[model samples]
Target: MSKQSIVLEPVRCPDCNQTHIVKHGKSAEGKQRYRCRNSECSRHNFILNYSYRAYLPEVQQQISDMAINGSGIRDTARVLKISQTTVMETLKKKTLH
Candidate 1:
């Protein structure tokens, strides 16, 4: 039997819902850089290279599901070991969808 590779999807900013992001450059620690195209967004440049939080794809999915499940932002953040700001930000972006 051969094993297949699973491609993890890239995540977008919670401010602007556009996936038209591209590499702007690299951070000092060599983390990937991203630029949002949504003109309404104040956060044009971002670092996708978090040393701890926001590294896992599953975590992002859970953040979405928790919001849909009526969980409080702080509650979700505590349970998921993420920042409250991240939770709120992700939920805010999810609303755009």
Candidate 2:
């Protein structure tokens, strides 16, 4: 019997959708991290899958949507099961961009 290596598609830069990625390091939780070579990319470093739900893009968008719908910081935090400070920080970053 022989072992075979599985081939996977190249990792892409989520922001730029570019395939020029290099391994940066491992996260504290042991997930692999990647860096994009695209100079125009804003978010350079990222993990393909994050262990924490709060760092997800969908969750961040939900936080913004809830805020736009007149939801309080505590309310959004409670609903998302994330820290109140995280909700505020996400909103701040969204407003800045």
Candidate 3:
């Protein structure tokens, strides 16, 4: 069998929809990390393989809405039953744009 490398699509910011991201390195958990080039972006680094509902646009929007509604991080995480890290990450990206 021939070994092949899968070329993953470049991830765009859900907030700004920009492709100006760079591979910053890897996370401590060994996940592929990316950095948004937009200075206005709040998240300096993001892991591509984040666990939970990070892939869903609806979930991302909810994260923002909840935050705007004065929802605490722990509260959102608990209500959504997702990791607090995921909630924090989602909100971080939203404020960037």
Candidate 4:
């Protein structure tokens, strides 16, 4: 009997949930990056996993929520274990949008 090869699943876009993805290049941290081909997709490029906790969407959302709930920069930073600058910047950008 001939040996069978293992099949791997295709990468799906996190934004549009599409299968039209292509390898872009490696990130500065040597992590793999992928690009979405869907024209209607708002996402430019994304990594399946991020090395930094501050870069995670959930963390960013938490930052915004905490700020809305009257949390100070120092408090948020201490709780999130992220930089004060990151919390401030995220708040600024989030408020602007």
Backbone clashes per model, in order?
Answer: 0, 0, 0, 0
Instruction: List the lowest-lDDT window of 10 residues for candidate 1.
Output: 48-57
Candidate 4 TM-score to native? 0.83
In model 1, the clashing pairs are: none
> Which sequence of candidate numbers ranks them by lDDT, best first?
4, 2, 1, 3
How would you encode candidate 1's per-residue C-alpha lDDT over 1-97 as one tens digit per residue? 9999999786687567678788898877888888998888877887765776654556878988877788988899899998888888777766534
Better of 1 and 2 by TM-score: 2
Query: What's the TM-score of every candidate structure?
Result: 0.50, 0.84, 0.49, 0.83
- Model 2, 1-97: lDDT tens per residue? 9999999998988789999999999999999999999999988899999888999878988998898899999999999999999998888889733
Candidate 3, superposed: residue stretches over 4 Å from native: 1-8, 52-78, 82-97
Better of 1 and 2 by lDDT: 2
Q: By summed lDDT, which 10 consecutive residues of candidate 2 come out lowest?
A: 88-97
Q: Rate the local accuracy (lDDT) of all candidates.
A: 0.77, 0.90, 0.77, 0.91
lDDT by residue for model 4 over 42-97, one digit each (tens)? 88799989998897878998999898788999999999999999998888877633
RMSD of 4: 2.1
Most lDDT-accurate candidate: 4
| Number of colliding residue pairs in model 3 | 0
On TM-score, the candidate that comes out on top is 2
